[model samples]
Target: MMFDPFGDFDTNGYLQNSLRLKDPLEVKESEHLAFEASLEDALAYLAKRKSIDYKAVLKTHEILFSGFYHWAGKDRSELVPHLAVFKGSKDDPRHTIFERPDLIRRSVEYALELAANKKRFRERPGEVMGQLAFAHPFLDGNGRTILLIYMELCYRTRFAIDWSNTNKDDYLRALSDEIQNPFEGHLDNYLKPYLLDISSRDEWPEMIGGIKGLDGLDKEGITYDNLDNPEVQQLYKTYRSQRID
Candidate 1:
C-alpha cells in the first residue's frame, strides 16, 4: 500500500517524474520553470479566445502542467474519482463537499458566469474565486491554475491585484476561511485593498513566481465524482454567445 498523499514520488521525496528531482525544493524549482513557460502559453491562448469558460480553465492547467503531469488537462473528477478533502482539525476538517465529477463542468461554468460580469466580479471577486476553489476541479495545480484564471478574469475587467504587496499568510488564511464560508467575502475584503489598475500580462508569471508559487494548499487530495448526469453545456453555449466578443 503506497502512502504518499502527493501521488507517486521517488524515495527521496521528489515527485517521481522525467526531471528526476531529489527533494521538495528541487521539485518546486522544476515546477516554477514549467509554470513560467506555461504562463506565456496561457496569455497567448487568452488573447485569441472570445471569452473565458470552464474549457479555458482546463486549457490553462494543461498549458501550465502538461510538461509535468500526464493528467494536466483532466480534472479530479475524471482522474481520481472519489471524495477528497483538505484534512485538518483532529484529522478531519469541516469541508463542503466538492462539486461531484459530473457537476464539475456546470460548477465552473457558473463561476465563469459570475466572473464575466465586470461589476459583480469586482464587487464579489472572492465569491467567484471561492465557488471555483470549492469546485477544486483538478487534483494538482489548483492554486496556480486558479490564480492565473482569476488574473485573466481581472484583466478582462480592467483590474489587477498588486500581488507584490499582498501578504501571503493573510491571503492563505482568508482563502481557507473563504473556502469554509464561501459567500462571506473574507477573501475579497482581504484582496480588495490591493486591487489596482490593469497591468501587463507579460509580467504576471514572474510576479506570481516571486510569491513562492503554489504551496501550503496541497493537503487536499484528488477525488472522483460518480454522479451520472452532466449539465451546463447548453448554458455555457448561451453564456458564450452573450459575451461582447
Candidate 2:
C-alpha cells in the first residue's frame, strides 16, 4: 500500500497471502474491525500511562505484540521479554533492539510535547510510535505497532495521516536519519516538505464530495467527518491533487 501507488517498488504478495478473508465485505466487517479495536486500545493505554505509570507503556506493548503475533502465528512474549526504556545496556549498538533507547525516548518526549502544545497535533499516537521505534521495543511487529499507534492517535485527534499519498522512500529515509544521525538534521528536513505541502491547499469541496474522490483502497476506515473539518479538508484536497498527479 505504501510503495505501490506512489513509487516504482515491486509488490511482495505478503499481504495477499496473509489476508485469508473471503471478500471486501469480510475484510471491512471482521478484520478491519478487530484491527481497529486493537489499535484504539493500544493508543489509549499508551496515552493514559505516559505521565502516571512507566509500567503502562510496557503493558500496552504486551497487548499490542500479543495481538500482532497471534495474527502472525508467532510467540509474542519471547520476542520482547521486558519493557524497554531509555538509558542502560540497551543503548549499545551491538545489541540491536536496545541500541539508542535514549534517542527513542527523546523522540517520544518531543512528539508528546508537540501534541500537548499544538492544537492540531495528535496525542499519544506519534509519540508512542517514535518511542517504540527508537527503543526497538519489540523483536517483531515494531513497524506495524508503530504504524497502528500513529493511526489510532490520528483518529482520536482527527488529524488524518496521508498514508496513501506518502512516499515510503521518503518516510523510511526520514525515520532512518532520526535513528542514525547524531545531528538529526535530515529527519526534520524530510518531513518538513510533507507538512508544508498538505498545509498549502487553499480550498476544497464538501467532505462528502471530496473524500469520495480518494481511492477506495486509500480510505481504510477514515471518516467523512475528518474530511469535513476545515483544516482536514485542506489536507484532503492537497493530497487528492498529489494523487491526481
Candidate 3:
C-alpha cells in the first residue's frame, strides 16, 4: 500500500481539530486523520488541474467516511462550488478558521463574482487566489483549496500568477488588503507583483521543478536545471534515468 504521510496514525489532522475544541479529545482522532489526508490530496489534485469541474471536486471526498457531512449524503446532484460551505461544528477547533457563517457565504459569493467577471476585466490570478483565502471558506483546507482553484482558473483562462517572485509577506499583505477593501485596493496590490511577473514572461524553473512529481512515477522528477532547456549530456542523463526495458 502507498504510505500516506498524513494518515490515521498521525496528529496532523488532530492538531487542526484542537483549535476549536475546549477538550481536544472531543474529536475522533482516527476520523480526523482520514479526512485530513483526503482533503490534502484533493487540494493537490485541484491545484494541478487546468479547469474546475464540479465532478472532480465531488470525487475528492466520495470514498471518505465523514465527507458526506459537508455534501448531501448520496446527493451527487448538487454541484460543489470551488469556494463553498465548511460544515464543521462551531464548538470544534476547526471553527477558528471560519468564525462566522455569514462570512463564509459572503466569501463564496465574492469568489463567484470574481470568476464571473474574470473575462470582462484584466484581473490578476493571484489577487483572486488571495481573495479566496481571505474568505477562509473551508474549516480545514481553505488555503490549499483556494490556491489550487485560483491557479486552475488562471491556467485555463491564461492569467497565471506565479508566487515565486514575491515573498510570503507581500502575498499576505495582498490577502489582508482584500479583507479590508476586497472590491478595489487590496486585491490589486497583492496581485500586482504576480501580474507583472506573468506579463513579463519570466519563468521560475527551480520552484516548478521542486513540485511533487505526478503520482505513481518511480522518480520524483525534481531537479535544479531547466529540464526544458537541458544540455545534451543532461538530456542523456534524464533519458537513462527513466525506467526502460
Candidate 4:
C-alpha cells in the first residue's frame, strides 16, 4: 500500500515529492505543513466562490498540495489511466475501489448534482461526501481537497458539521461504510448528530488547522493494480453497478 504510482519511490521519494523525503513520517510532516500553510488561502478562495465544480475541486487540491507534489492538481485520468487505486489489498473484503479514470469526472459531477438540492444535501451530506471519496480523483491530497469542496458546499447551504467533535476513527469507518453502500445514509447517520448552524469562515483557518488525521485515509493502506487485471476489472464493474446513473 505504498502508492508508488510513479514507480520512483527509491529515488524521488513518495509521489516524487519536492524534497524526495523517503520516510513516511517525513512525508506526513511535509504534507501537513504544506496543507496548513494553504488552508487559510484555500478557505478564503472558497469564500469568494459562488459555486464549485470539478475544476474548482482540482484547483483546491493544487492549491493545497502543489508545494509537496508537482502533479498535485491532476486527476487519475490524466496521471495514471491504466491503474486502479484501492484502500487495501485488492483481495480484501474491506478494500475500497475508487472510480475508474474515465469515470472520475462523472463521479464528482454526480456528487455536485446531489448537492444542487441544498435541502437534500443538508440532510444527507454523507451521500455527497461518499461520492467524492469514491471518486478519489487525485493521487494524493484527496481527503483534504474534498473537505474543502465539502466545506464550500456546506457554506453555500448554510450548515456545518463539528469536525472538532467527530472522532477521526469513527468518521473514517462511517465514510468507508458509506462508500461501500452508497445512498444508504451510513455517513448521514453518523454526521446528523454533529450537524449545526454554519460557523464563521474566519474561524475555519484555526479550526481546520487543529483537526487531526485529515490524512488518515490518504497516507496509508493505498495500493494500485493494473486495470487489465481480471479481478480488478470485476471490482470496477461491481462498483459501477452501484453508481446511480
Which model scores highest in lDDT? 4
Ranking by lDDT: 4, 1, 3, 2
Model 4, backbone clash pairs (residues 3+ apart or across chains), number = 0
Candidate 2 least-lDDT 10 residues: 200-209
**CA displacement after TM-score superposition, residue 187 of candidate 3 (Å):** 2.9
lDDT of each: 0.68, 0.38, 0.40, 0.87
Query: Clashes in model 3: which pairs?
Result: 19-93, 20-92, 20-93, 21-93
Residues 34-130 of candidate 3: C-alpha lDDT, one tens digit per residue: 4455644555565465555434433443433244133311221132222222223223332212213334445545555566566632454544554
What TM-score against the true fold does each predicted structure earn?
0.77, 0.40, 0.46, 0.96
The per-candidate count of clashes, in order, stands at 3, 1, 4, 0
* TM-score of decoy 2: 0.40
Model 4 per-residue lDDT tens digits across residues 85-118: 9998888989988888988999999999999999
Q: Give candidate 4's whole-model lDDT.
A: 0.87
Residue 208's lDDT in candidate 4: 74
In model 1, the runs with Cα more than 4 Å from the true position are 1-16, 20-22, 87-90, 94-97, 199-202, 212-245
Candidate 1: residue pairs that collide: 81-224, 82-223, 82-224
RMSD of 2: 16.3
TM-score of 3: 0.46
Instruction: Point to the candidate with the largest TM-score.
Output: 4
Give stretches of model 2 more than 4 Å off: 1-37, 40-56, 67-132, 151-160, 196-245
Candidate 4 segments exceeding 4 Å error: 242-245
